[model samples]
Target: MKLHTIVGVALAVLVATAGVAAATPGANAQDSNSDDAAKQGPPSELPDPVPEFVSSIHDAVSDFLDGALDGSLGDAVNDVTGSSQSPPTSADR
Candidate 1:
């Protein structure tokens, strides 16, 4: 429900802003400022996404998967066994 609301809002904003940049080549001029896109500068002052954060997330996921495997290895193996759990039928797909 929260996701739907956020997505709806985002879609609405995107729709509203659609063709806006192109409609006015002098976009900044409308706002009474520089009209150059590059001159406007990046909104985010920070650097591009840091690799350390990505590595941390990856490590966390790896630890979770490892723990899950250790705790439920049998269930995981059974999941792959066609005899135990048949492959998804067309209807399931």
Candidate 2:
């Protein structure tokens, strides 16, 4: 009885897998047709905004860090050293 049950279960799984495999090609063909249609449309200059937004945020953070290091940190160091020298400007570089 156990052997019969195992054979039945295996046969059912085989049938299910074969059915899925047979159906997959048709589904993929339909998808490819739709993809081809989409490809025929006008190309985008920029399809994704993620990299642009990321670079903008990166620039903002870098500018903030530069200001903190060059402006505030330099003044603090100068105060500790008791030096009358001003923080170096970009033009000084």
Candidate 3:
């Protein structure tokens, strides 16, 4: 057999063995006490994992995109109707 063919077969066998091992129960079993860790949630004094600023920024971006899309649609309609009016600006709101 060619060298590449032999190497390919070896790699395939190794992958198959690994897959079988991973699928087998009791292989690298977790500790029986692992459930104890979940009993306690995040530390008491710590702030929320997600900060308010992150959410505010996300809301701002979402609002901006929504406004842009609305303007684009309005512009499309105006173009189709041969109206020369400009799209409404944020100040118009």
Candidate 4:
């Protein structure tokens, strides 16, 4: 199959390049970089937007469950009972 051929080629390439690698680092320069990085603290960057987006989605779902779906369920119950399909107001709570 095509997948088998692709995997076979990948393995062959890996074997061919197995010995090609960076030389081991010396003692002086490597320690200096690490020491500087430690002094610098965490990297400065824009906040990740993923959490905010996830929070918005969570809020939306909460709103739907707390209000929209609740009202719809009340309407459905009213319909079955041959009552007015109007949504429940706060005073009805």
Considering every candidate listed, which one attains the maximal TM-score?
3
Best by lDDT: 3
Candidate 2's C-alpha runs over 4 A off are 26-93
TM-scores of the candidates are: 0.24, 0.28, 0.37, 0.23
How many residue pairs clash in all the candidates, one count each? 0, 0, 0, 0
Candidate 4 lDDT: 0.61
Error of 1 at 15 (Å): 1.9
What's the distance in Å from true for residue 86, model 1? Answer: 46
How many clashing residue pairs, candidate 3? 0
Clashes of 1: 0
- lDDT tens string, model 2, 1-93? 699999999999999999988877663364545767677657667565564445544554565577744446556555555679998889999
lDDT of 2: 0.68
* Model 4 agreement with the true structure over 2-72: per-residue lDDT tens digits: 99999999998887666453344545544645767577656678676674445544554566677744445
lDDT of 1 by residue, 1-93 (tens): 699999999999898798685686773354545366446657767768865445644554565577744434334444434248644557988
